[model samples]
Target chain A: MVKKLRNYIGGSWVDSTATNFTPVVNPATCELLAECPDSPRADVDKAVKAAQEAYEEWRRTPVLSRAQYMYRFKNLLEERFEDLVEVVVKENGKTRDEARGEVRRGIESVDYAVSVPTVMRGYKVEDISSGIDETAERQPMGVFAAITPFNFPMMVPLWFLPTAITCGNTYIVKPSPQTPLSMELVYELLDELDLPEGVVNLVLGGKEASLAVMEHPGIVGVSFVGSTPVAKIVYETCAKHGKRVQAQGGAKNYIAVMPDANMEASVANIMGSAYGCAGQRCLAGSVVVAVGDAYEPLKNELVKRASGLRVGYGLSETTQMGTVISASAKERIESMIQMGVEEGAQPLLDGRGVKVEGFENGTFVGPTILDGVTPEMKVAREEIFGPVLSIMHVPDFDTAVEVINKSRYGNAASLFTSTGKYAREFKYRVNAGNIGINVGVAAATASFPFGGQKESFFGDLHGQGPDAIEFFTDRKILIERWL
Target chain B: MPSLNTFGAILTYAIEMESRLRDYYQAAGSEERARETDKRRSNLERVRRENVTEIKLEPIEGLDEADYALNLDDASAAGQQAAESTAARFYTDTAPKINVREVQRALERCAKQHAENASK
Candidate 1:
């Protein structure tokens, strides 16, 4: 049976205003899985209106009450976690394990949002001046919008919306058109918590829908995650419109393999960072900068590990890697691979034309590796957003740091080394927003703020952690005099 | 006669404007999602204004309406295709080209940076 696609507006599922329908395709089989309503301008308006109306009461809800709702939402997410993972894997084309990880990360955000009552508490000072007292409090920012990307459809939205709603702000989410179902399911889960109608809404559209959100006066703030180009646009437009904005963009994350680093551990970490989810993640380590003479060894190890990866449908229990999101991604990654080859980087492992058994119709790109990549190459500079890892050799630690710092993106970078001093120095010197030593993936926990720097992120509010609550809320200082 | 610097500046400005236009559309859509009631009218207005502005700002001369519309449509379709293709390829193939855990760790680093910034 085909699943019906609906927009969640004011806590209710409604059909699209337009007759047009977008078929949800399984990337693995190139088969139609379901259909989604092509959310028209009218549908977007209805959802937005519902959220605005709900905001009147939702914004007034007691912090403690909001906290209660968040707790319920968290429980609901956990309850539906397995189903959610399935949907994510099927629709998003991520491996089942990766889908589960995304869902778990999303649930963690909701769990953190549930603690808003404690996190949102204000600070009070007895006296600043004679007979004067001051107190500071956090307040909801009316209505807020979240523009999430296709990657981590569930987790990225939760990274912002949960905190926004829990902090007493109504939320409107424009999930990526590529993976709208996963987010729509999340909306349904949120609805079961019985939060006020219109407090949370989901609109599925493309640029037209996103522009509407940025231009609308009712939206007090906007949070977004996507490529750098789009993030820049979101940031500039919202800022120009006087709305608080946080838009994360692209990344060309680097993993610097130091001389003393354990070859096996580093290879394993690099394999996961570069190939997991086929490198669709915003924080994927696209560039591997090897310090000293470790480049050749690390490259060999990475290739060996890459070759051993079991690629299949995300639902396959034995599969370690899954297909890329769609057919076009395969083309792009292939093109980038071609570009890398043309740019003089030696192809260690060519993933192009890789065919999976039984899933021949699936959109699959093999894990690819390029060696002797220079900093000037497009493969090294641009965000490939694929499972193609480029290895650039650097003579010394300073050179590695320089190359990393020189990139336009500053999302994340890592160093695999045993020396504490070298690790500390690399962490301090790297221009990346996130840094790690011996660890490949450096994503922050729920308690830590998450964002990037330079072209990688375009706004003030980073998603999750303590900053998330603050992003969803505004600060108000109160002054009083008692004679 | 535009100098090299002037031409470069103009190119940069055009790129920036194109980015801003895309963002504005996204933000407007986000607004519609949040507000819901005035979605169609606002979206139409925003799209219309952006189209007009984009056309007016076009550096090429004598581009007709049909051509412009076709170009815009092509661009949009291309973007959608790109997104879908990228997603599809990543999900199907199993020759592990990149590592998932490492990517997560890298994302975590960004999260940590934000946390540190907040404390300050």
Candidate 2:
């Protein structure tokens, strides 16, 4: 049976009232996975109302109790870890192992939020004026909404929900219309957790739902993760509504290979970072600035490794990379590759027109490596968000850093070096939020703040860890004295 | 089979472990180092207090203190992290055997929290 996916609002599985629906496709086989509701503004209203109605009771529930619900949710997630991973693989088209990593990251967010008792703890100070006592407390900021992108339907919602809900704020999630089935399962599990009705709600759609979420008066805050253009829209709209927002934008993350770096390790890490998840992540190392003596050898090794990747269906054990999200995504990535070729960048290997066995209709884009890529090339500047690596050569570490710092995106930057001095200098000087000394994808763990700098991230506080607590709640101070 | 212990015994052991961690972080916090390290030590102290509060909720009962030993191998930041990790795993192992559902979950939550903090 084709699953009739619908919104989960006000403690019930509610169908979208709109007549039109979007077809959810399995990118691996170009198969129709499910029918996601093309949710309208009214659908957003219902979800937001549910969340706003549930906020008072949810916020009044003891923090420990809120954490207990998260524990239950986490247990459910672990018990069905493989099943959810399959959902991601089928719906989002990432390799099984990659899907597993994404699910683990989602689960890890729940695990971290289960520490809300500590994460949300406040402060006390006494004897300011011979008996004056002062205390500060953190309280939930009411209903919040998250607009998750298609590439990471499971992981991105988790990046917001677990933290927001555990901090005693109710949430409304608008999962990407193209990939809503996975979140359907997430809400199904949440249904069994006995949380207060409307504490967690789901609205499935694209722009309309997202815009409604941003403009809704009940939504005190908004969290979003997607491409830079939409992120800016959400940020601006939320700001106009006088709501708190954290919008994580796009990236052209760079990986610098220093002369002193180990060639073998750098090649391996770069291949994984650039090709893993079909290079559809904001933290993917799309550009490699190979400095001085490292350029030739590094390019050769990178090409060799990029050519060796096994591309097939995500469920296949031998498949190292999977399909992009949709047919349009495939076209977009391929067009970027062609643009690189036209711009005079040497095509080390072109992934365009690649076909996979058994899944002839699958949206596949094989690994592409472009050499002699200049910073002025559109492929080098924009986020291709695919299995494409652009290699640029520079004379020294300073030149490489200079080239990287010139880019508008500051999501992540990495340095591969054996010299501690050079590594430390690069880390300190890199104009990115997440930095890596010898790491490729310098993604922050659940326990640390994960965000970008400048255009990459808007707002002061980032998501995850202590920053999540700050984002979900507001701090209030009190002064009292007794006669 | 490993020796069985009461809820009080485990709680006491966890409290002792947190005390050792607190001492280690406090010493590290006082040392002249990078400002980031100072922030880390302060965060560790907060985690220590949180662990103590959760464990304190369990009822006291008869379980020998001799089986538990509080020791800190090192008083550095790395050492404190190791202690927190050990404590996290201890709670994870103890949770299933904990007869009360609420207490079991509390312990599990602490375990996951410390494990998270250890990585950070």
Candidate 3:
């Protein structure tokens, strides 16, 4: 009951010419939802060329006119918000609540784009030195493409697309082959806006399609969100081709808790940070560092609450946790959990053998917590990206921050503490891009830049806010001294 | 009690409550129920869209979905009274417990409506 998904290029849904296609299976029921066409390099070329053709006219269009499209798109999204959220739930395996949250974030980005005319304003000075004037205007770069990850099919691409297009750059989006339908649905909405034919194009595929976007000379910039390893390759490839690139990679975020933290609130937030979205997000708190006097109580409460979470299909009303993205993802996550156990970390709750009655074949992994984890273990340092939390006990906050800072990834870290001194110190000392004080996930909203440091991010600017405006446009300065 | 350990979980329960009420009203088939069905349906969409931000991840304590369960199976006038009373009690009991100001206010308004219905 599944048909081959098509690529939306040149304002219409066109079938990919590739001979091969990738299977997209629902993680909850193991049903084939659709077959994603493994679009070849040629599709990417066509998309970029189309975008290039559109950019010439789109760039000349007034910024206010661009903002109008975003406003209408925002209204359209709100009108059909539930339908989009349902698509996210079915395709991405996020619970309805989580999918709603994702759409909220995505729409918030579109909402932000509506204010682009104000945010993208340039600077002008009447006189710099002796009757000289200076003005700097933000001009849209040509064609840009975003290669988004599967975990957030709607939100992640929306993070870049609205701003990129509103800033006057024609765009091509290559969604993860695993979950391209949500973006395809979004593209339908974009097509309804009826801008120029190629203003925003969607190309679906795997690595070859991505490589084409990177290697294509017409594409001025590239935006990527995925694994750190692949992000590095994208960065290097874009560099060799002299294109601006922003590549957000994997994370192993930590949430350090102090003894004085409100235990009830701390435990609840920790459950969300570690287990929400089944721990697939880049900002997900994968490690909990318990400081002196907080170890026993925090560990006990986290395990108790996590074990109580109801795991089922995303569509289930009361389901608190859902399956990982795919069977292979489930396998990888379980193997990582096993690896942690082999490395001498204690598994307090093993989710491996859990099964739902109707969805016996569902790739479900119940919430799992591993204790006695040290800083040296691979599970402690690596990105597990599953509903797995590793606990490490430290004597004090300094040691906790030390353990967190030693990691190669610096995406996010949070401190749950009642002490103002500890909170301030943690904020000052932590190397992560996002820091949380008495909070769980340090994720940034659309109004602010979603940041990453060290190996976690590879770019001059970030995904949202003013960083996105800068990323999509170049500043052109004019100095005049008219006699 | 069914645990609702975060604002997200609480909001999810709220959405289920409204959607169920809408369905129940549609099944009742009275003119009032039919009118109430649209109100409940609008409330469901409002709660779903207006809320559900990433900020809802903050912890919620001491709320349970079981406390708000509607006894819609009972079809008599007495059962209707009981359902209204239960809905009133849920909104009254949990309104202040919600820390988000807008959601708390919404629950209070819902409580007032249910309480008025229960009295009638």
Candidate 4:
């Protein structure tokens, strides 16, 4: 019997008032792992009240003392790193290496938070006027909330929670119902901190609970990561309520391949970019624009190499590609591939027919490459969020950039080329927020902001690095002097 | 015999070996060798983390875990000697099969570490 998970409120695990519960299933094994409550509006209110009460004291704690908790937590996380990796694999269906990378990156966020005392320093300057001075200090707001996505359940929340708390803001997290177990484990670690109750809280639920948090007036800011349409809703809702918002949305990234690009290195990078994390990442390269004569051989090598990818359950060391999040995701990805085929694109390597030996019930999608894809096709324009790669041909480097910039999403764009002229030009004029030259996964580190432009992101500040500090705190200015 | 079908599987086997051998040396009298084993494990973990940044999807065909598997139940000096030789052979055998340049270099260094231990 799978136990239903609870909401951690006021430093205790309390059962939600919700009558509805969503099943948290392992995407690789199709096992019902746990039941996540569909928390009610009242439950969200209860969490807000707890966070608000804690914020009164946490905001007053010395900034250096607040950062001490972050460093200790980072050490605790390292000591138990592999255990968290196991939970991530069982809950999120990432392979051991992928789970390790996710957990490590999440820990890196805590590492970034450790610099709160330094980065959160106030700026003061002596004025030109006699005996006068001006000062600006970054101070924490009240309660903040994060509504994270299912694809990166653990990493995304860490990107917000640690940074927010280290800046002395109390936090409430509504982790996706599909993958709440990882955060539950994290909250268990946070519980050992011996801090005051309600400094950091967890609420597990579906849409109702998320909506409640978004609508709550007590929350000073709401950090969200999900689809574009829903991101717009979060942006509008937070704006209407006059709360600070950072809503990261969906993406359709393109990687242009010049004929002079290193075939061996480019193929390796392209494979990792298009298929890593089973192509669920926002920075995933979904479209390949091969310039002129680079199309045929690149297509052949991509098909041959991608066809050889070992697909199975994540725990298997031999398995390279894991499953999509759930059965519905697998179905949606297959239907998207079929739609591409119906629209005149050829299915060069179909993943729908691929299967693992023991995981017959798993939601697996192998490396899918769609050839002869056009710019206007649904597969080329839309975010499939699966292990599907669409290949298209362009006339030259200029045409490739035009095709890439025309997309509605501007999350990330990469160019595979040896020519400095094209690389420099592509980086300068690309519409995306992150540009990659001779690289595929152009993700920024925890010390840098990771968000998008255009329709891909809806706010000013992003989720990681200095942007997080800037997002959670506001600068107060002082202009006075006593002679 | 553990099946070593890919580079990930091979690294997993190596990690398991490091832990067992480190435990064996710590329980017996060789504290210095145990520390070396622990350091090697940490290095291999670093490799594991780096390799995942871009997983090499190519299947490794020829390596066998049976060629390097050790019987650590014995608690004598000969057992330690055999374990060191096995570790050396595991790295020497697996280095050529590695596709990634960093992994190959790390494996070479590991082989040298164990070879020095076996000689002493």
Winner by TM-score: 3
Candidate ordering by DockQ (highest first): 3, 4, 2, 1
For every candidate in turn, the CA RMSD to the true structure comes to 20.6, 15.2, 2.4, 2.7
Compute DockQ for each candidate against the true complex.
0.01, 0.02, 0.43, 0.37
> Any runs in candidate 1 off by more than 4 Å, and if so which?
A1-4, B1-120
Worst 10 residues of 1 chain B by lDDT: B52-61
Residue pair clashes in candidate 4? none
lDDT of 2 by residue, A1-483 (tens): 887788999899998976778899999888888988888999999888888899999999999999999999998987777688789999999876677667778888998999989978899999878899899999999999998888888988998898899899999999988889889999999999989999999998887888889999989999998888888888899999999999999999999998889997677677768887899988898999999999989988888777867788987634667899989999999999989999999999889988998998999999999998999999889999999999999999999999999999999999999999898899889899999777787878788988698788887778888998999999999999999
Worst 10 residues of 4 chain A by lDDT: A92-101
lDDT of 3 at B62: 68
DockQ score for model 3: 0.43
In the range A1-483, model 1's lDDT, one tens digit per residue, is 777577788888877775766678889977787776667777777877788888878877888888888778877776676688788888878775577668777877878887888998899897788888899999887888888888888889888888888888888988887788898888888878888889989887777778988888778899989999998899899999999999999999999998789998778667778887888998787989998889778888888878877677877644656788888888999999999999999999999999988899898888899998999999999998988999999999889999999999999998998899889898778887888787777888777998588899887767788888778777899999977
Model 4 DockQ class: acceptable
lDDT for each residue of candidate 4 in A51-105, tens digit (9 for 90 to 100): 9999989989998898899988988787787788778888878676677778878
Error of 1 at A393 (Å): 1.2
Candidate numbers, best lDDT first, in rank order: 4, 3, 2, 1
Give the Cα lDDT of each candidate: 0.74, 0.82, 0.88, 0.88
Model 3 chain A weakest 10-residue run by lDDT: A314-323
